[model samples]
Target: MLLTQADIDGAVGDLSGVMRRTPMIASRTLSERIGCDVWLKCENLQRTGSFKPRGAYLRISRLTPEERVRGVVAASAGNHAQGVAWSATQLGITARVYMPTGAALPKIAATKAYGAEVVLEGTTVDEALVAARRYAEETGAVLIHPFDHLDIVAGQATVGVEILEQLPDVDAIVVPLGGGGLLAGILAAVKPRRPDVTVVGVQAAEAAAWPRSLAQGHPIAVTAMNTIADGIAVARPGDIPFAHVSRFVDAVVTVNEESLSTALLLMLERAKLVVEPAGVAGVAAIMSGAVDLSGRVCVVASGGNIDPLLLSHVSTHGLTAAGRFLTVSATVSDRPGGLIALLELLRDLGTNVVDVVHSRVANGLELDEVAVTVSVETRGPEHQREVCGALSEAGFLRE
Candidate 1:
């Protein structure tokens, strides 16, 4: 049976005090870009740096006394593991988490800090889940299946409840889809009373599974996953959440890897928010024009736990994709004044030089010619074109 409004209310009560009422603030930047009044449901600031704890806390708190005694076991690449660990810690229950060997070190350390014993195994979350299941069976511990149980759905639905309370006239809600717990929960909670509100789900293009699953009327596992949005890079939609998605979600769309990086950059630079690639999927959808939304729109910024190294790399990629950073390779005179002349030209054009690579050792290069690659930062797309035109005009363009 589909979750009722009462189920959502129950979750709200269960989450009282324990859950952080994350902000729902207006965004002028996104509003102008999307041609709608935009609001952000910043679950990135939620405890555990994600919306995972909402469901995790409620699910673990509702455990039977016997189950609580046996503790809980969970498998996750990042967010879910921290959620279960934190929830179990609060309720004085033992928790064991199985994380992929490739899981980020910060996330693994965070899970361990939450008082859960973490076991690293295999290469992906799917493999870690197998280990978690076996451990649960062997130890008789309750397994916390992320996004697959109704109780978890109920918990995630609270996000919808909060949105309506915050933005009663909201016309559309864009959410990130992985196993579909967040989207399903929001749909269940929002659709009952506000059936007019259009709900859309966004996924990383490489890891998307919902579109096929909804089309087939069943959960279909995506065979391959290569995305920086690893938190939402789920291989398959969960059966329970898939039912809700099939019945309720208006549309499921995807954003490419470049779009994900750009969205993260947008959040960092424009919104002053640090969001993970998975969390920013909704924003990426809007930025990529994957979803045509208007009126008052709300996008859930889902999580903020990202590796610093990955953040640095994605930041550079985002800059390049947005045309805010440019690399120009040009062959300049080997004499001392040639490189200086190019630098002066860039300076006069008001571009900030990122770096310069001067090399005289290419196979076809004349002894008097030095090939130099100059990287500079531009304002945007228009500025990028201006910079390129100026270089080509100055006889420094390399093909």
Candidate 2:
């Protein structure tokens, strides 16, 4: 479908009363670090804790009354399911959603709470999508696509319009690309208004299928892989979205898991925002040095539907990546004063003890010795190395 400026403007007008005009907040820390003015489009704080509701609500609102009465069906990993369910509820329409069994519990609960009939059908989104399609055909329900549809694309385009208004001099925008709706919409709206503004897309390195798909000029199914950024863990790119992405998107970069965790942590600690892994992928790309931003930049934090457990893990991972957490094992004598002496040595190096595990028989140490695992929190790698050196000098054989 041809996505013109008129089409985008009309969609924005139709949904203006329903959708939010989310704020565009500046990130001084990021701007100073990257040598560019950086703004964070915090869509993670949107109505459904994601930007999906913008497209979902617009799509459902535009449907005919008969279609709404027939109900809507959709398949999503998490965020889209919540968006569709919430949007359907707003339109007073019955919604049936199929989600992978492995989808985050918080997301499942949120979707169900939004008044949709949630179905746990498969282990992967692809499997759930197949079931959703079959159910839609059998029940004659209007199938609302998560990202591929023209209406959905137009709906998401409103974000670009908001960004333009918020930061007219925005030199570039970096978006997290999954099924490509967000990227496509932003590109459609931004490129037309400011043709020179660079539009970049980011994807989880482990689940990056768009690069290969774009190279082949078709939507290719990336193997459904596990990633912390479940929101953008799409196996395939949308056909309609792909068209716009190819035309206007300046660059598509991939960031690793470490980068994602670090970015999320930074958002929580420095930016005072709770961003999910997917929401932070744009910043992850920036931190990973995958994209060059020499001018004003916008990083779209797409969602904040992170699981509590996952957040804990991401936090720990971030600390570890930043060298604030360290784990090392050493062999010490079995005598009574040996463990205390080792502790004293660590204290001398100014390393704070966080956790310690003493193993005697299980670690296969000699009968006269034991393996002691120490987990310490230090200032950084230099402090950690200094502590390790102190241990070694104290005659603790480290592994």
Candidate 3:
């Protein structure tokens, strides 16, 4: 059933002491950029490093003593796994979390640390979910789905209640859409209190299913779900959350890979916040100008559980997108002084050379020519252009 205000209120009361009331802080940088009074609901700092516990704790808490004795089984990429594990540990219930083989190592470790028996299974969440279902059926364990449940949605809706309480004059709210539990919950809570407030939902462009689902008037599956934002990489929207999204969410948009990376980096550099790629969907949407940045907008910073290796890769990509880093290849004379001369010119132009590879055996190179691929740190787009112009003027042919 679609959640009502009473359900959300009950969830807020139920979640007290169980969940931290995550802060809503003003972001001056985002506010200036978006031309609105921007605020961030910092759910990333919530217990278990995400908002998942809000729903997970509530869902497990509602289970009967007999059901708890049967134990709980769940499949998740990361956040939900930790949530369920932590919640079940507190409730003294056994939780078996099936995670994809490729799931982030940190997430898997954290889940296990929280007292869950973690089973590393298939390559994707959906595939791992199959294994989890089999385990549940065989063991008579209750399957705690990541989303798509009345109680879970009600639990997630408590975030909206907190948001409304924190930012009473909030004109708009932007949320990251995965299975739509968070979005559905927020909508159920806020829409009833203030129906005029605009609620926008964002998804990774590569894995988005909402646009298509809304178009076809039913939940439709995407062909592929490969994305850096693995947290929101659901192939199909959950039927339960879809019902709420259709009724309440104002707009659903997708952010490309580059935009997602840039947003993540921006949050780290400007806000000193380590937001996961999926968690920064609202920021990505606002920064990319995909969402309407009207007055007093609050974007939910959903989670902060990101793999360090992935963060490094995304940071470099974000630097590239922002024109802070550049890679250029050029052909110069094969003489020793040729490479030195190119380096001198770059140094004179204030370009910091990060790495350089010089080779004469590259395909299409002339007998007297060598190919030099240089990766440099630049100030911005203008510095990159200046570096390229200076190289071209020095008779280096860019490749």
Candidate 4:
């Protein structure tokens, strides 16, 4: 069924007390960088750490009493699993979530913590989906698709309603696109009201499918999908959402892995918001110039359910990308004070040493030589260059 403005209005009314009207905060840093008044729709702070519940709850709530009694099953890498689980618990129904074997540990734990039976199967979400479907067929359970139904689209449209109410002057909206439910919903709700406002969708370059699907004039499956943005790493576009995208979305873009990491770090460090890689795709698009950033722009911070270990790795990668961290290996004399002297040089150069390792008896080391690997924090690229220059001038040959 095609979703209309009236359907979205009904959804907004139905979801009044069920969902949180997440904050829309102004971002001065992003505004200055993009030369526009930037606002962040902070769905990352929503219940279950994503906007998934907005659609999940609305879909499950509309289920007949018999369907609810049979319980619900869903497949997700993280966010959607939590949404379905939380919604099922709220409605006094049983929930079973199928997750990929390699899904983030924290997400799996959180899904189970939310009172759902967690099943770990396959290596990707598509694979887990197979298991979920088989279980639904065998047990007569209702399968709740992540983003392919009319009700789901209408539920997600409420986010668009909130955006317009919160920022009526918003000229552009950038959102992370996976199966296109969120983008489709926003377009259905916002386009009719403000035809001049632009709606853009972003995807990870490594896992993008919409561009190819649009070119083919139908949903096309991506053969190989790999990216750090697992939450949005969908291989196929949902038919229901693709219809709305083709009709209303202004443009779609992709951001590289480096930009995704940098954007996540920027939100964490500069915006003081903990956002996942997928959640920050809109921000990445803006920072990388993938989207037109004119007039009052709103970028959706879609989710924040990130694993701590992955966060640590992304943080280090972000630091490297921003030129705030450096690693150098140099050969030095095997003398006792050789390492100390090199460290003193770094200290004199005002570089903060993060880690250091020294070794001898290596392929490039002479009998009286040792290789010292130093990891240091610098102010920026220029500061790193200065430290390297000082080390080279002090007779520490970089290896």
Q: Which residue window of length 10 is worst by lDDT in model 2? A: 390-399
Per-residue lDDT of candidate 1, residues 179-293 (tens digit) = 9899999999998899999999999999988888888889889888999998998998988898888998899999999999999999998899999999999999998899999
- Cα TM-score of candidate 2: 0.97
- Which residue runs does candidate 2 get wrong by more than 4 Å? 362-364
Off by over 4 Å in 4: none
Model 1 residue 196 distance off true place after TM-score fit, in angstroms: 0.4
On a 0 to 100 scale, what is the lDDT of residue 90 in model 1? 96
| Candidate lDDT (C-alpha), each | 0.93, 0.90, 0.93, 0.93
**With candidate 2 superimposed using the best TM-score fit, by how many Å does residue 61's alpha carbon deviate from the native?**
0.6
Give me the displacement of residue 121 in model 3, in angstroms.
1.5
Candidate 2: tens digits of C-alpha lDDT, residues 1-399: 659878898888988778778889999989887788999998988898999998999899888988988999999989999999999998899999999988999999999999999999988777888898999899989899988898899989999999999998889999999999999999998897799998899999988989998888888998767789888888888889999998888889999999999899889989999999999999998887899887889899999999999999999999888778888888888998989988888787777888999988755678999888888888887887787777777778654
Better candidate by TM-score, 2 or 3: 3
lDDT over C-alpha atoms for residue 170 of model 2? 88
Give the count of colliding residue pairs in each prediction.
0, 0, 0, 0
Task: Return the lDDT, model 4, position 102.
Answer: 95
In model 4, which range of ten residues has the least summed lDDT? Answer: 390-399
